[model samples]
Target: MSENFDLIAVSPHPDDAEIGCGGTLALLSEMGYRIAIVDLTNGEPTPFNDDPQVRLNEASKAAKILGIERVTLDLPNRKLLDSIEARMILAKELRRMRPKIVIGMQGMTPRASPDHYQSQLIFDAAVFYSRLSKWEDIFDGLEPWRIENVFYYYTARELLTQSQPLQFTVDISTHFETKKSALLAYKSQFRAHPSYNPPIIDWIEGMGRYFGSLTGCKYAEIFYGSNIMTMNLFKHILD
Candidate 1:
């Protein structure tokens, strides 16, 4: 039987969730939330990473750092397509995990990798498909499950050109270091390749601090929700 989760982050590649929402995941885990990340691709054949096994190991290590589970789907890297088959596969997983909150990349990322946008479409469709009673037979007869919330997390690659206003910010000040550790675990993709990219860790830290300043926190992560969120009380509001 599949384990249920309070939150599930859908990523285009193995390290995307770590790069975009690692601190948030770590904070949630510390708060005793059952969280998991589903990577659409293995993020292989990169400039520095040619071995799929190495990338898998790195993803596992990163998940451990955030105290969450990680599952990778058999999707082609750099060739993601938003089709019915793709949506059904993801929908099945959603039904199996039954997460209340679903996190995915922003839907309109024209400048970033195409896979990011494609991933958004896949998740968007899967969320709706997961709740279709007629598809229960196709999805292993699992009960229809509807996600309560769908949030989009920004990636470091889109930081410079991101224009979407933040719907809310998560105060991950305490889990900043935990996020860093998870990102650094992908040494093959970020640190090991000296010429592949600059100091991404520095950029991630700077981004966190910038977002935190906006919400009066030491470090934070921002997200956009598809629907307006209602708060019954002001106790959870940040200072």
Candidate 2:
């Protein structure tokens, strides 16, 4: 768990990461931490032009806006299966990246989306496999890697129901707008559809503003973890 990465966010689909923690990611990147986003699925069933190349281009542009690196796993979106094969693939990625903090949607419940469960499986495998020695074979015999902490952001489930309080909330007063702007890049996913009411873009933006108000910021993101995140108290908290 000694490897240092500012943050590694795993998403079930292309836009899940941004919708959940875009504000936090923007703030973290500004603070000089190396950031990475991994999209576990290719999101084929999404209401787009049905071209993988187009989605890839959109994702890349969005990553550029946030100043973070992006990686797509090409996993099937609606049909994500958390099998042993899937875990091994994610395990290899974790070992290669060696992130300090891992964040994702807690696959705690059977959600309507297969993407959710798929992400949960990846997160589950990543947490432990990243630290194991034998898993090195999964990543071309590379050295084992362990992240310092794991935090699950509130996306589908409420944080308090499953985990303790987050060590702290990111004050996204400055980055919230930028984060929203980045999210707008995925126009294909958020447009008003006949079946999908409550357009996602509107909902996500409102959630950011609402969260930000809690910490005196115009917009913000929330994260929760089971472990205590220690700080210098006086210095880190004040700063």
Candidate 3:
């Protein structure tokens, strides 16, 4: 929380944001937008990753690659629960950051990780609770703030067979390489066991290209929103 940010991306693990929306973040950072990531967990104690500090270092490198600030909460990995305590902690961070746009996990994963859905629930609750004037006593001395927009990014382990339509697609052809670099920063997760893991980098790049083709771009990232966004017809729709 150094200064107010234009956007904040909430992630379940250290590399989740980079895997899902790194290109969008890199593009925004190049446009001089202040972007930050709030990681729900340190993403450690896995078969390959033992030290949490190593993961933090990797996350820091990824954040630097994307030119964004990163913060990690002390939540348990693989066991994140959607509780009031969790919501309040996230709400305090949201109040401190005061981002206009909030991006979080889609939470519609076919994977068995409950942390994904819990992260989504926490983001939903924190957004609403951060605007509560009555919670002044709980969230330090920060003022109440309401987010302008809420969006969801994809980070499922497997390719989705069916899903809801994307609200929008961001053309990230120019920034796709940057996104790859950020993803590569997590060596412990993706590159540690090349033989055991599928070609994750290739899959990520292919996914971007596939989404890009849908929007007539070379590379892109898809996003979903529950609420309709009002836009200027002449400025955006036509142009």
lDDT of each: 0.83, 0.71, 0.83
Quote each prediction's TM-score: 0.91, 0.85, 0.91
Model 3 score (lDDT): 0.83
Per-residue lDDT of 18-92 in model 3, one digit per residue for the tens? 878899889888878889999998877767888888889999999999999999999888889899999999899
Candidate 1 lDDT, 65-111, residue by residue in tens: 99999889998888898999999989989999988788998755665
Q: Is candidate 1 or candidate 2 better by lDDT?
A: 1
* Per-candidate count of clashing residue pairs (backbone under 3 Å): 0, 1, 0
lDDT accuracy of residue 39 in candidate 2: 86
Error of 2 at 19 (Å): 0.6
Residue 77, model 2: lDDT of 77
